[model samples]
Target chain A: MAELTYREALRRALDEELERDDRVFLMGEEIGRFEGSYKVTAGLWAKYGPKRVRETPISEEGFVGAGIGAAMLGLRPVVEIMTINFILVAQDMVVNHAAKIRYMFGGKVGVPMVIRTPGGAGAQLTAQHSQSLEVWFAHVPGLKVVAPSNPADAYGLLKSAIRDDDPVLFVENLVLYNVTGSVPEPEEDFTLPLGRAHVAREGTDLTIVAHSYTVRRALAVADRLAQSGFEAEVVDLRTLRPLDVDTVVESVRKTNRVLIAEEGWATYGVGAELAARIGRACFDDLDAPPERVAGAEVPMPYAKPLELAALALEDKVEAAARSLLAECGLVGSA
Target chain B: MARAVDEVHDVLQDGEQALRLLRLMLLIRRFEERAEEQYTRARIGGYLHLAIGEEAANVGSIDCLGPDDYLFTSYRDHAAALAVGSSPAAVMAELFGKVTGVARGYGGSMHLLDVDRRFLGGWGIVGGHLPIAVGAALALDYRDVAGAVLCQFGDGATNIGAFHEALNLAAVWSLPIVFQVINNLYGMGTSVEQSSAEPELYKRACAYRMHGERVDGNDLLAVREAAGRLLTRAREESRPALLETTTYRFRGHSVADAGKAYRTAEELASWRERDPIARYAGLLREHDLLDDGQLESMRKEVADEVSEAIREAAAAPAPDLGGLYENVYGDERWREQFERMDTAAPFGERMETRSWQS
Candidate 1:
């Protein structure tokens, strides 16, 4: 194992995928020679040459659609949007074409494309750059949405996404890029299965389900809960669309209480989907109704205080978990 | 008239191809006319945009393409679909929303797809398919294939964000995609002059540092020649080009409207005089390429073919209800999941309970 930052792990995954498969390539603004807008593709152009590492103009819709077209022709294209905000320009291609092609064509073709974009709010990038639009993509049927919370999962899930036959929306949190973790040693061929959740920690009192940046927050909250004599299990949902509801339901069955955390707005977000699924699969297993600690329902405010209040933090997760435990009559007075 | 004679002399292939172009234009015109009648009779549902007056533009531009080349167009696409060799019957079946339709009636008039014929689709949203076409060109170039993408859109799309994005990407990548603008004067109700800052749509291609040309859309010979040259250049050199065919639409944006809200009777009559089929037929007679009898027979044959297709499509059954859950994913696991869901109590009960309050 080698320690790597989230961004470096992503770059390493791209390099390894390109090396392993000649058909795999990367295209986006500033991804070649100039590195990347976030430096996630630094040194890739020099290593693979311009043919594999392509630099596109600031035409998100065009390049994204072009990626789909290339995918249709059996090329695996990893398209990088600078941020989730710029992705709006290409939503029609992502939502209408990439998401519906397989279904509309009756499985005649597959979109083996990975659209990677940095998402979530925290970097003082203001409202436009900070919105979490993963739910919008997750709502689409034919597409897969994956969000990796750390370095290892970033490398693992990205390789899986590149090799997968379906279009995958690989979301990265801007705040987690510099965070470091041990990644598997570089290999010519490496892939991790998609739609599987990883149990960050095993506990018996309550199950905390989260993804991306929220997963880190949940881990922190779980640690804090342990200090308070409460054991909280944390499940990091690396892939959102396929959801791995079985793992989540199994965890809920073991714990009998669940708390869903997401960085997006509370209503109709990932949390709502998880809550509904848990309600369906583990309604009897649940000791209390599933609680969701999600970002407040509004555009991310610019003010620091309001922004802090809007996001789903460790405090919110801990509080929601405590309330669930109390409702289940499992926790004594705090 | 002399220019017309000169263009005809330049590209006319034994006069049969000219007759073919005239025949195709007439077929599209009559097919759309019949579609209009069906829409009025409520046999066709949803938005029914016609290409009645713009048949020459569609046929002329498509005539330039090789069999391996691809074609993409906007919603008003009956003529383009036919010109690219989609059977008139399939086109009619599509308008009638039959399961035998090109896209199994799921596409209706706006979305038409024939992958084998290399006709990508007729996208409903303005300027939406432009980028996808450029992408297809990119794919062709990546595979080292000698083909270009003929992407047709209306004048209104020129001002949209997708037009700029697609053109810029195509120019930067030097992809073999020809951006064909069939400027039918109005974008639904909005005129070109009103929507676009630059009314000369062809000139906008220069902004992307790509080649551009303007041709008289009613002049089928000119459109074919220009498109042929541009497509050749694109296929040979892997370069992007834009061709603006200044055409007119005889009908309203759709079947419901009489098209009176936008233009005057005199304007309509003047455009009608430049009818692509009539003009091309007149040229064929002038050159002794086609006689009145042959033209009449060609029209009758095309009409009969379309009628037969309609009859067959009407007899075809609707798509199987089981297909509602089909094609959502490529994996068998997903199919199994869908099957499990189908077997579960219907989604109505579960969905009703989870419906968003807002």
Candidate 2:
């Protein structure tokens, strides 16, 4: 096993799924001959041919609907929208049809489909390109939303998404693509369970709960805090919809303080949800009120400085951690 | 045994089948009339979308389908469901919100599902069932099934995003599906002319690069002829087609609507004059297919059958409370798993052990 970038691991997951199941295929804009918009399906077309690694026309609604139809007929279709923002075009197919089919039919049928897309801001892709919609999908009942922060988890989660018996919304952060980690060699049957959070780093003073790119930011802040003698635990909430609040509550109970982080706008984002749930579940255990480090409320700005200001960077997360420490009466001692 | 196109037409024009279509249409008209009465009395809950004047369109289009063919429709689905072989008792029970109803009383007037009859569902949202119908057609083609899907929606749905997406996919893949648009002119309160750029709804099908046909929906024979041809083409060639049946709804959109706000009383009278049942009865007499006595006897027979069904459905028991959580998840174990997780160790217990270390 060798370290693979987030994009490379996603490619490996698609490659393995395609090889293992003849029915499994990838369809999206520029997925075939052009590799992928982000190279997540770079060499898959060459390996699997046009039929399996399909290059669809730029009709998100059409292709996404077709993928759902294909999945209904027992085909394992992996539909990729270039980004989460583009998925809004196919909201009817995703929310109304794919999410409601199994229940509406009295469980007679199931839509075993997967929609893969990149999300969040940091690359300065501007307003239209960089919105975080995990909370929107999470609000929906039937959809299983997963946002993987690193290469290993991306590989594991995508494989599981393709194989699951329900529709899965698999979101990858655009900025995490080049960052690498050790990915196991492709196996015939490899799948990570959905609705589980991983403890990326363990500490005692405060628990940092985050998903996608914010997981990395939280970990970096934890590293910096470690140097200053404050032990900050980090929890990577891989799946946003089926929030693994038990793991979060457990971490908070041990740490006694919490810092929630997300790349979405500050109001009503995933971080807001995490903080609310923590307050409800472990109210008595809290040493301090939960702190949230989130992106600015404005539409993601184009100018570099504005974009930088709009995002909750490592410094903000670090400051939030220090604030939590201050409330816990550990800042001066640390 | 592949038959010639002409032979298929000849087979469809049998005396028995013709009578069956007429009977089905008559039954639907009477059933809807009864439903309207029930809705007026406040017996039926939720929206009661009546498919009154559009009987010919539903009967003619559904008559072209085989037993294996799938059918999905919008909320105005009582006629469509009946034509697809769902028992009148079950449909009436569904309207009554009884447990013996289709979907076990879960889905009310808008969402009727009968998997056994291949009646997919009556989706509540306009244009919502379009993509689902396309998906079902794709499933049929992938499984090598020799059937097509008839997706019924109103003219209003033509403007929605799902309609464009579903139709485009159907065209691209050549999926075996028929987009049956019952153009009764109004989507809720908005007229087709006001909502759409093109007054001819059939022409919108051309945008998806699929074959489109406009039939006089008031004429059952014409609707049957066009539907039969297109459905045959869909089954044999795996091509999608859109068949718009231009008709009018004699009643308002729902029972509560007077339909007077949007349409003139004279216009409503004009459509009522071209009622599918009355028009077909006149045609049968003109062709010496049936006399007045036969038609009258047939009407009485249908009325009796509808009455019996209503009585039975009224007596049917309500759904059991224990079955509430039955079909929420695919696996039964999710209930146990959710329960176990809900009752797991409280945060207080875990915090006590860590307090000593602190």
Q: Who wins the lDDT comparison?
A: 1
lDDT of 2 at B329: 43
Error of 2 at A304 (Å): 1.0
A188-268 per-residue lDDT for model 1 (tens digits): 355567777889999988999999999999999888888878888999988887777777888989988899998888688
lDDT (0 to 1) per candidate: 0.83, 0.83
Q: What share of the true interface contacts does candidate 1 keep?
A: 0.42
Q: What TM-score should be assigned to candidate 1?
A: 0.93
Where model 2 places Cα greater than 4 Å from the true spot, the runs are: A332-334, B1-13, B321-328, B331-358
Every model's DockQ, to 2 decimals?
0.49, 0.41
- For model 1 chain B, the run of ten residues with the poorest summed lDDT: B337-346
For candidate 2, write residues A1-334 as lDDT tens digits.
Answer: 7699999999989888899888787889998888889989998899888778777778888788778766766788899999999999889888887887676655666678899999988888999998998888887766889999999999999988888778889999889999999888764355677777899999998999999999999999998999888888999989876667788989999998999988897677777777777787788999888888888888999999999988989998898889879877787444
For candidate 1, write residues B101-136 as lDDT tens digits. 887766678877788888877787788888878878
Q: Write the per-residue lDDT of candidate 2 for residues B238-286, one digit (tens) a residue.
A: 9999999999998788888888899988988888898888888787766
TM-score of each: 0.93, 0.92
Which model scores highest in DockQ? 1
